[model samples]
Target: MNAAVLALLLCLASAATYATAAVAQERLARREATAEGGNRSLLRTGAWWASAGLNAAAALLHAAALRYGPLTLVQPLGALTLVAAVPMGARAAGRRVASGEWRGTLLTLAGLGLLLLPASGPAPEETLSFSQVLVVAAASALAIGVLASRRAARSGLRHAAASGLASAVASALTQTVAVSAGRGGELLSARVIGVALLVLTFAMGGLLLSQTAYQGGLGAPLAVVNIVNPLAAAAIGIALLGERLQGGPAGVALAAAGALAAARGVLLLTRTAAQGAAPLPQARARDRSDLVGVKPAPAPESATVS
Candidate 1:
């Protein structure tokens, strides 16, 4: 098969790998929550390490895929990891996912599929020249990530938002590195032994932040983050590197469809969350009455989203 075809397959495999890792992460969170009042450690429980491992595997797969595919396909496909994690989390918690979640997941995948359809041709193998673009992109991505991570504790969804932004910035830098690096360079960096280290460090930081965000708000935030990351990277590609998208309006239309699908998925997740939020005030009011022993309440009901 051609390079584009190989890239497309790699992209899909990367998505699947990411999704599996996310399922593991969601399960770990549910387990952590269950052990909340008990003695536990992230290390002993193997949660952090497992997450790191799966994520590393995914990153390796993604980087290889990137060598074969376009950024637009690879990054968007990775977002599915978040979408897949929600139901997995619910399952781990022994709760059934709401119908809305199922709908949302389907919508997200459908949209992503639109964006991943192979670009026709053997794929560009342009020889690249080392430039300052990668370094500048790195600095900018790090700055933005630090800014966004400050919001993680506010709400679960905020976590997703932060992760998405961080991932986008990191991807932007990564793309710059991949596209700008000279194929002719004998060394990883032109001058230093640690240049690859910086690249690896930024990439890992992005992954860790994104993982945290996914744990807090697995769906909506990731959806938004996933969508926004590529858009930003693509924008960078267009403006800085003179990258041109193949196919005129048709390709764009397909991508728009994917964006819309992902958007619908976000709407479903947020609406379910909103619906769940509605009962909280009423519950609080009842709790106040119960404090005075006024209302003889039934035992605390085990409520789960269905």
Candidate 2:
């Protein structure tokens, strides 16, 4: 089998695992209040640990995918996590999959397909220079800082986008580390250490933001993450890594359109999930004494009493 095919499969599997983890983690976030207890209780839960394990596995697969595929190709495939999550989430919530959900899922998949079809070729494996590394670190810190600042006031969409971008930066750093490793560079080198620190900061920040983003339900936040992570990584790949698509302007246009379509699907799915998660209106309890202003039966008097 070709390495590229294997890489694509690995990405798909990673997406599946990630989808499961997202569902599990979202449930944990809903069950345990992070602000009140700082996720201590949540950390102890089996579900939390299970999700963590799945995510770890997915990360390994994602790294492997990056090793064999271009960033633009592999990253966008992560959106499948959102597609997989909808049905899984529906099952967990004891709801049937709606038509709109299916439509959104199909659109997302089709867009992903279009995006993949025109990829010119695998990107050349390139290592970041010292200057590039510094730039990435500085940019990552600033972006994450800006995103973190809004966490207290922002809605779920913003939180998700922030976390997704953080994760993307981390992904880009990871790719650089991989390139270094592939070129026989020492892992303990200064360059590796600097990048590793940036990766750790962004990754942890993204994780926490994602947990808080659950207030709006899994679909919205997960969709944002799916959309943002790839786009961010692809941008970094093009700008920093000198990656390019083969088909020139036309290819770029198609890719952009596909991305927009996928985004639309994600938005639709988010809205659908939000609607599903909404609680049914409850019946108000009536006070026992009022009885809707109806008078109670008069007390019985002695028999034959006037």
Candidate 3:
């Protein structure tokens, strides 16, 4: 088969794997949230480890796709994870897919397609120097620290954003290591080893952050991570790696519109998720009564208790 076809197949497989892994992780997060003590060791959870394994498999598939396809092709296809995740998550939760979730997912996907489609040619082949790597690492750490701070209100969304930034930085470092290795540079050199170590550190950090994000719900948090990952990676490519967007002024305009659309979609998804997560009025009243040491009023005879 041709390289493009192979790449397409690999990308699809990767997207499916990613979707499944997301669902598993989100379920595990929910379990951990509701479990007593809330301090259950992730290492003791079989599903948590299983989800991590699936993520590793998906990464391998994605890397293989890049081998046979250009970034312009492979990167946009990664957005399919969000597309697949919505329905998969609904199915996992035994609920119907909501209309707003579908709309938000589609909008996010369209915007990502537009945002990634402007790179008309291959990016420059380059590797980050040790100093450049340090700078990038510091910047990513600061961003993640702020977003994942305890003061953040939308804990899930903030954690998801932090995860996205961490994953993006890790991708950049991985690219550096890949380029260096591909060019027959010294793999065991101090610089290369240090870069490799940073890659692992960020990758693991992102995984933990994403697990936390999933505790809120699937659609909105996953959308945030998926949306931020590529945009941040593209920004890194443009600013630090000598990459350029195509079509000059027109491309810039298109990318800006895409970014706006994606942001709006994320907002819609976040609102929808929040609405779904709100407590029922009856439940809220009952909880309030319980708080004051009063019993809730009895329900009507015909009313369902649940």
RMSD of each: 7.7, 10.4, 6.1
Ranking by TM-score: 3, 2, 1
- Evaluate model 2: give its lDDT: 0.73
Instruction: Assess each prediction's global lDDT (C-alpha) against the native.
Output: 0.57, 0.73, 0.78
Residue 139, candidate 3: C-alpha displacement in angstroms: 1.2
Q: What is the lDDT of residue 70 in candidate 3?
A: 47
> Which candidate tops TM-score?
3
Deviation in angstroms for 157 in model 3?
Answer: 0.5
lDDT of 1 at 258: 76
What does candidate 1 score on TM?
0.70
Ranked by lDDT, top first:
3, 2, 1
* lDDT string, candidate 1, 7-88, tens digits: 6677667666766666665444434443443223444555567777877777666666666555655566666665566666
Q: State the lDDT of candidate 2 residue by residue for 156-230, as single tens digits.
A: 777788888888887888777776777775677998888877777877777777877766677767877877887
* Positional deviation of residue 25's Cα in model 2 after best superposition, in angstroms: 1.0
For all candidates, what are the clash counts?
A: 1, 0, 0
Model 2 steric clash pairs: none
